[model samples]
Target: MSEAAVDISTSSANEIAPGIPDPYSLPLDKIDVSQGELFRQDAHWKYFERLRKEDPVHFCAESENGPYWSVTKYRDIMHVDTHHQIFSSEGSITIRDQLEDFVLPMFIAMDPPKHDEQRKVVSPIVAPDNLAKMEGLIRERAGKILDGLPHNEEFNWVDRVSIELTTQMLATLFDFPFEDRRKLTRWSDVATADLNSGLVESEEARQAELLECAEYFIGLWNERVNSEPGSDLISMLAHGESTRNMDKMEYLGNLILLIVGGNDTTRNSISGGVLALNQNPGEYKKLLENPELIPNMVSEIIRWQTPLAHMRRTALEDTELGGKQIKKGDKVIMWYVSGNRDGEVIDRPDEFIIDRPRARQHMSFGYGIHRCVGNRLAEMQLRIIWEEILKRFKKVEVVGEPRRILSSFVKGYETLPVKVHPL
Candidate 1:
């Protein structure tokens, strides 16, 4: 793997309107990073800028399972995200799915009225006021998780801190049986990781695990559907109206989606924030000096880490972009990791400054109606977690190399070994 070289896709060079010149032409699979490696680094920014300027809308024909277009420019993604009718999210959101009727969740897989309908049930539940109520619980959990970290010992922050805290908090919110919280996080990771990738296969073990999650949730949803409305998301989901009520099957599917969406992504953010801070000690010091900056620093971490790097969006109609022509049914990969560091939008795009002028404008949470439903909760978690970290620890240092996942879709650390000391 060449540190200076970034993988660039060529489909855009042929079909895209002339915008930027392609510097490196490599197969999409060639550009992927392993779990512990620092990927999509400064070099990635150069490739993205070249694409944005020359072929802002290019295609990567050799994604592991299939070919897809890479959309790197900021405005192009925004345009596609806004025009949901033209650039649809429902048909082919993931590149490796081979199912017939297997859309994962109601809202994440829908457009407009239906998307709005499904999102309405829980959007209010995660709103600022509702999220504010969760801060105390989140802080308590974050403290317990961090405090329990072994003193004078190195540990993988991903499993010990990131996954544990995020999943436990998610269980708290979902009213899930806390004993099964780890099961929820594991299933969510497997289900969302590229199916073609080896992590999740058609093996009986995988199938049984998935069925276990479904059966557990099916029972929970069945009870809630008949019971009265409560404050938790499950109660609202059970009681919410639609053209038809979401049956136990749909509720289970949506539960898997929520658990995955809310779990791994934010867990990655929490872990990634620690990594970014350790990498840039100055930034870490800034947060420690003025803990108030924790809120603003959350955006910087999202941009720097870009946990769920890019989501696949299929085009509903033939479209022309950056001089390139895209056909109907074409799959476009929105590289939010690239777009967040777009040279046109961000200054010193490669540098990790904790307080960039327009840091909030980054596409880490994504754009349009599909913007992360747990975004507020994610920010709340980060702010409170780090605020508590600052109170407890004076210094944090990465003790060893991080292990990154083999799959390309969910970009995050598999193992982040680090050591921390109390102030």
Candidate 2:
């Protein structure tokens, strides 16, 4: 399906509801941060703050996605993330359960030996050697995109820059058809979007679009499976010992994983970094003064954005966390967005400091077995783009309010109006 054919919008989700009470005003048990509307309004911070302070391991007896435990503190989230044995990633990784009829079995949702084996198959794509080879190509693409931006004109930075750059990169990684690159963005959006986000009409529609994605990739797999091993992701999966025999559903699951992982997280971070800089002028000035801080600022951007807000893990065995007893099969959500702002772990947690010490120490990439495999690649893209932006533009000024995506899982932007000033 073409990107334009998919009508995903945040208009309905972005409407501010009447009498929105403060986080503290609500009773403890009544607080549910899983609502997508809160994220759409950028009002989830206070709710998470309240949970981190009073109930680090609070259990929501009810939510749109059903009962789940929220791990808000930095250390507590780290514990759950690292101890995959106690907290399994088996069934699903989001707060919403996967449709039993349309389950997609990707490596990120697998346990033990299976996950490790499947993950190892594609790890080489981002290895030190491969990334070094990819650096020049990425820089070239970033420069062209930046150079092409209209100067002294208000534009949607999310579409022109963030989506364009990341979608191009995803096309490169998958060796997908460059002309149809926007489909990657659409698929990623559809894969993680809340049903009520207006991204799709219903679960059936969502599944249908994803199946179209599956069919397209399956064709690529067929063509590559017979050819000599190539460097692209599809080639790797087609030729790899472990992934070569994956079922159609498993293949589609991994494709969605790679597409979303390669697109949304980095794309949102690109938009978020610009928004963050505009929000914190001092940091932008700090960056402009010493362009050397671009690399460091990239980590800070990821931390500040916390793009993929939370990762859900199902408890394999009953366990206690932060004094809360987590029963077996309970859905446990590690609120990475909240953890990135925990005062106990991050200094001046709410502030955006570019030269912050130990900047890479954040929960955005997750931890342990499932820590983001393409983290370095994501950082590299951010660094190169910022470096290029600095070389040409004095500032990418935010001219209007940024529209947030209505998704508690994928915290991102739908649109961010900006006007570029040449250096």
Candidate 3:
């Protein structure tokens, strides 16, 4: 749990490249990036940079989660992401494989026909037509949130705006009670948080909270089961032919996946946007002047922040990748955060440019069959928020350093102190 020392205030990439005299003197295999502290301290960038340059498919013989292969290069990660037949997502999608009896059977952790069938059930929720319908609602909420921010006073943007806005959307999607919307936020945190990260004290505590989430959702599921098919997520799952008879544990798993997936990416991106803008004032000026660039800017923000750092896949068979031999059942982690910053695939990868060409050519939404289903919905929310932000506020001043979350899986802010300036 030792945090790696790193200074992220400047825009410079780490200077430790291939064939250079090693300052740290640690061997390639000795460097492990899976420690949650690396991310909590914003220190993962240097290690990943070194890996992308020196050992794109580096292996760590030992870690908290045991041995795993690190895939840091862009094209190599894309190859693994697209070729699900070779690198499977069946057992788990985290560096730490799921516990024996606690395996969550979500589609992101599945392969093949079952994955396609299960994912199809909720696909229509974020389809183009549905997005069109959700736009006005999102705009109204964003406007209200922006209007409510305390002017010339520091506040936690992550809690007051990021979490609040996303939780409201999650409530609407689940058709859950509006009064209990914060419960959705709590459950989302519990679902993704590591035990020592302080969200929950132990695995028992985490599962207890999740089961409570399941119990609450079960009540909603019961109500929706007998009702006519509708657009809400619960109703869709209850009515979809393939999902109607989901086993209790499987149902719980899928619910958690949707809750966390729908909540994390967009919320973190919102907070990250504010932080990035304050850090790079010139880009903020460009955004303020040409609001139309917000769409492209949204993609860039997602890429730069890289909400989820990596997604793990188990090797289905022994295969050669990036000139490294991988054995069957080996854990292969695709570092999306690293790939997004890969200089080979992206121009000016380290700098945050709002108007970069091919802004969407990044790994934030992932690739292949397990690509985020709600990606468009997430982008729409960001675009709407920024549009509303431009119409009202001139700036969101980041008054202090952001407090980051402690898990490597969710790369995000826990608090970003800021004050809003009106236009």
Clash pairs for candidate 3:
none
Scored by Cα lDDT, where does model 3 land? 0.89
Candidate 2's C-alpha runs over 4 A off are 1-19
What local lDDT does model 2 show for residue 127? 100
Off by over 4 Å in 1: 1-50, 101-105, 195-198, 201-207, 247-249
Tell how far residue 93 is off in model 3, in angstroms: 0.8
Give the RMSD in angstroms, all C-alphas superposed, for model 3.
Answer: 3.9
Per-prediction tally of clashes? 19, 0, 0
- C-alpha positional error of residue 76 in candidate 1 after TM-score superposition, expressed in Å: 0.9
Who wins the TM-score comparison? 2
- What would the per-residue lDDT of candidate 2 be over residues 317-372, giving only the tens digit for each residue? 98899888889999999999999999998998898899999999999999999999
Error of 1 at 19 (Å): 30
Q: Model 3 reaches what TM-score against the true structure?
A: 0.95
Candidate 1 residue 287 Cα shift, in angstroms, is 2.5
